[model samples]
Every structure is written in structure tokens, then in C-alpha cells.
Target: MRLTVLGCAGSFPGPEAACSAYLIEADGFRLLVDFGSGSLSALQRYAGLHAVDAILLTHLHCDHMLDACTYVVVRRYAPDGPYPPLPVYAPAGAPDRIATAYNISGESVDDVYTFYGLQPGSFPIGPLQVTVDRVNHPVETYGVRVEHGDRVLTYSSDTAPCEALLRLAQDAHVFLCEASYLDGVDNPPDLHLTGREAGEAATKAGVGRLLLTHLVTAWGSEASTFEAAASSFDGPVEIVRAGARYEV
Candidate 1:
């Protein structure tokens, strides 16, 4: 399995990074998690806009889902000719909201991408296995555990520290978590996790690697935050950067 960080900023985008987007590939298929700003372009650079096999959305926040609307249009009406509909697995009610947010006719967009609503549990998508767990966020959100063969990767998308997330990521080879706030930078209740909080979750989950993402750019250097998170776990800890790829 291969895990790639497409975008990893929080609240909003950084000067060099986009918002939340991840590319996980296993068994020769690609799955996209969260299509934030510049993600479509990033995917294009990596493997063309049409190379994606499916999309799994965790929430409907602008930075997490907005680019999906744009992607639908491009795939549906691009001058290069239309591509076949890609299956999209997302939280309940996501399709309707995406259609409305982009001012797109449901039929027009629906013809280009088949949308599937996911609940908090396991589901299958072709050669991969997926498990969704509810997470703590302002809106309904999910953390996903994906497995293919002997490899597994879990992602906590914009969530606070929660038992559900810990259980979902248990024993994962890679745990991609969001640390949206610094310990003392105007903490937001029920919406985000601090760097240390993410570390604790990873340690409790017994993951092999802890990859910290969704950083708020205003926090300046994340060196201190990464160091703090590292204190909790003996595994590899990485502060995600765009264009970096990890093979597991």
C-alpha cells in the first residue's frame, strides 16, 4: 500500500500547502480522501485528473469537500471528452449538498460520479476494504480505516480526540491525524485536536507510524508541536508536507 499527502493544512490553506486531501493506493487502485483546494491539480500532476478510482469524503467542510464540486464539472464537461463516472463514497447527505453548493443540476453531476452514502462501519470498494468510524467535529465526520492485503492505513479527518477514532485506527500501519490547533492557540471545543492529543490517540491505537496533518498555518513553525506529539509515541512521527509519498 502507498499513502500520499496531497494537502494537509487546517482551518484554511497555507501559503505553500492546500487544505485536507490524501491519496491512498493499494492493489493498483487509487482512493482519494478529502478533495480540498488545489487537490485536483495535485492529482493531475501525480496521475492526471482522471486517474482517480474513487473518492471517500469525511465531511462537508469547504476546505475538505469544495474541490469535489469543481472536479465533477471538469470531468463532466471537459473539452478532452467526458470520462466515465467515478464512484464517490461519502457521509450521508453529501451528494445533495455538493450538487447544491456548486449550483449544478443533479442529473448533470450524477451522470459523472456515482455517489454512495457511508455509515459508521465497514464497507467494500472493489479490491479494498474500508471501515468508517464517527469522529468528533462540528458537523458529522468520519475517520476511515482502509485495508488491502496485509497493509492498512487510517485517517482521522478534522476531528477531536475520541475513543471511536482510537478504535478505528488500532494497529494501523499508518495513522494520518489532524492537529488543527496548538495547545494554547484559542482552543476550539468539539471541533479539533491539539498536536499532543493526536499523538496520544496514535499511541493508544498502537499504530506503527503517526503522521500529523491539518496544521493551522498561523501557528508558525510546527517544530514544537511535532516534538510535543513525538513525546507520546515511540513510532515514527511525520509532519505532513504536500507531494510527499509514503509506501507501506
Candidate 2:
């Protein structure tokens, strides 16, 4: 499996990076995780948007799902004409909410792309097997563990350190977790994780690699933050900077 970091900034677009978005490709299938603000441009530059097969949204936050609605329009009205239906996976209640937000009719959704709302559990999606788990967040959110053949990739989405996250990512080849705050930043009771917490989770879960994302724009150099986080884990720990790629 190949992992591409289309965007990695937190909250909103930064000078160097966009928001949260990732492209994972394996076995001729491409899956996108979170299409945040300005992600389409980065995706087009990195992983061709036309090559996308499916999109997995972690939540409805503006930095995660905002671009999804616009992307549908772009694909449908492309000069080359509309392509086959693309599969979009999301947490429960996403279809109705997003459809209303996008002003799309259900009848018009005939295959060119369809939304599949997932409950909290394991399920199959195309050639990729997925395990979804609820996470500690203000809104209804889920983290996904995607498996293709013998390779496994787990994404924590946007969540505080939670047991479900550890369970979903345990022993995975790659753990794409969110570190939305710096060490000293005082986060609210149930919001996001700090860099150290992310590292601790990856170490406890026995993840092969810890790839940190969703970093606050004020977090300074990603390399420095990741180095600090790595102090907690013996395994490989690195920040997912914009335009970075990893072969997982």
C-alpha cells in the first residue's frame, strides 16, 4: 500500500499546507481520507483526482468534509464527461446531512457515486476491508482501519486519545493519527490529542509506523514536533507534512 499526504495542516489552510487529507492506493484501488479545504488542489498536484475510486470521511468538520460537495460537482461536470459512480463511506447520518448540504437529489445519485453510511463495526469496501470505531470527539466521529491483502492502515481521524482508536489501530502497519495540539497547549476536556499522546497511543498499539497529522499551524517545524513525540515511542514516528509520501 502507498500512502500520500495530500494535506496535513490543522484547523484551516496554512501558508505551507492545506487541511487534512490523505490518499491511500493499493491493488489498483485508490481511497481518499478527508477532503479538507484546499485539498483538491493538493490532491490534483499529488494524487490525480481522476484516479480516485472512493472517499472515506471521518467527520463533518469544515476541515474534513467541506470539499466533498464541491468535488462531486467538479467530477460530474468535467469536460471529459462524468465517470462511473464513486463510493463514499461515512459515519452514520452522513448521507442525509451531506446530501441536504450539497443540495443533491437521491435520484441523481445513480451510481456515478453513491454514499454509504457505516455503523460502528467492521465491513468490506471494494477490495479494501475496513473496521470502523467510534472515537471521543464533540460530534459523531469514527476512525477507520483499512486492510488491503496483508497490509493494514489505520487512521485516527480527529479524536482525543481513546481506547477505540487503540483497538482499531493495534498492530497495524501504519497508524495515521491526529495531533492537533502542542505539548503545552491546553485543549478542552474532550477535543483533540497532543503530540505526546499520539506517540503513546502508537507505542501502546504496537503500530509499525506512527505518522502524525492534523497539526496546528502554530506547532512550528513538523520535524521538531515529531522528534519530540518520538521520544515516547521506540518505533518509527514522523509527522505527515504536506506533499509527503509513504510506502506502507
Candidate 3:
């Protein structure tokens, strides 16, 4: 399977940056992990607007999901006649929640997207098998594990260090984790992981690689975050770059 980082900015986007989106492709199927603020534009750099086959939203936070509003418009007004509703797997009430974010009613957005409630379980999206587990976050977030044949890729959408994340990331070829806080800072609990915590999780999970995302540059230097993770994990680790690609 191949993974692409369309965007990785955290909280809010800086100039020319976008927040929290990923593209996972295998067997010609494109499964979008999240479509956050400013991601729609970035997505076009990798694939066509209509190329996405399905979507999986980890949580309802705007920084992680709001650009789905723009996605609705893209499919709803495709030069071709309105296309079939795209499948979207998300938390309960996502239809109403995203519609509200877009200032429209759920019924209107429903025209372009079909909603499926995300629960803790395993399911299939095209050729990929996905397992989701609740993670440590303010909202109802889920960390995901995707399998294509024997390859595995895990994503820690937005979370603090937690057992569920460790289990989901267990033995994954690539652990795409979030490090929103620096190592030596006063950070709130149950919101985000520091680079050290992320690396610790990777070490415990025995993942092949640790790729840190969701970094808010205002908090500290990216190099410092890299140092923090490398201090804990004795494996390939790096601060993920937007538009970077990975094979898992």
C-alpha cells in the first residue's frame, strides 16, 4: 500500500499549509483519511478532485474534517451530472455536524455524500481492511489500522498517548502519529501527544517506522520534535512533510 501526506499542519494552517489529511491507496483504490482545513487545495496537487473513492474521518474537529464541506461542492457540481453520493465513514452525527460547519442543513449535503457511523470495529473499504479504536482526545476520535494483504499502516488521528493507540499501531509498517506539543512544555492532558510520547508509543508497539504529523510550528521547532522522538525510538523516525509519500 502507498500513503501520501496531503497536509499535516496542526490546529490551524499557516501560510501555504493545511491541517490533517492523508491519502491511502492500494489496488487502485483511493481512501481519504481526513479532509481538514486548507486540504482540498493540496489534494489537487496529488489527485483529481473526483478521484477519491471513499473517506474516513477520525473525528469531528474542524482542523481534521472541515474541508469535507468543500468536497461536497466538488462532487455536487461536477461538470458531469451530480455524481453518486460518496461513502463517508465518520463519527455519529457527522452529517449534521459537517453541514452545520458549512452553514447548510444535513439534507443538502446528503445529496453528495453518504454517511456511515464509525464505531470501534473492523470493516472493509474497497481492498483495504480497516480497524478502528477509540483514542485519547477531547472529541470522539479514532485511531485506525489499515491492512492490504500483509502490509499495514496505522494512523493516530489526534490523540494523547493511550493503550488503544498502542494496540492499533502494533506491528504496523508505518505509524503516522501526531505530535502537537513539544517535549518540555506544559501541555494539556488527553488532547495531543508530544514527540517523545509518540516515539515511546512506537517503541512499545514495535512499529517499523514512526512518522510524526499534526505539528503546530508555533509551539516549537520541527527539528526539536524530531530530536525528541529519535531519543525514544530506535527506528526510522521523521517529522512528516506535506506531499511526502510512504510505502507500507
Say which candidate scores most in lDDT.
3
Residues 1-248 of candidate 2 have per-residue lDDT tens digits of 88899998888988889898898888888889888988989988997868688888988888887777667777777889787778888767666655565675543443356778867988776688989988999988899999988888999998998899999999999999988777765668678888788989998999999988888767455665676679887898877788898888
- TM-score for candidate 3, please give it: 0.97
> Which portions of model 2 miss their true places by more than 4 Å?
100-112, 219-224
RMSD in angstroms between candidate 3 and the native structure over all alpha carbons: 1.1
* lDDT by candidate, in order shown: 0.85, 0.83, 0.91
lDDT of 1 by residue, 123-151 (tens): 88767899998899988899999998888
On a 0 to 100 scale, what is the lDDT of residue 170 in model 2? 92
Ranking by TM-score: 3, 1, 2
Candidate 1, run of 10 with poorest lDDT: 104-113
Ranking by lDDT: 3, 1, 2
Q: What TM-score would each prediction reach against the true structure?
A: 0.94, 0.91, 0.97
Give Cα distance to truth, residue 51, candidate 3, Å.
1.8
Off by over 4 Å in 3: 104-107
Better of 1 and 2 by lDDT: 1
Candidate 3: C-alpha lDDT: 0.91
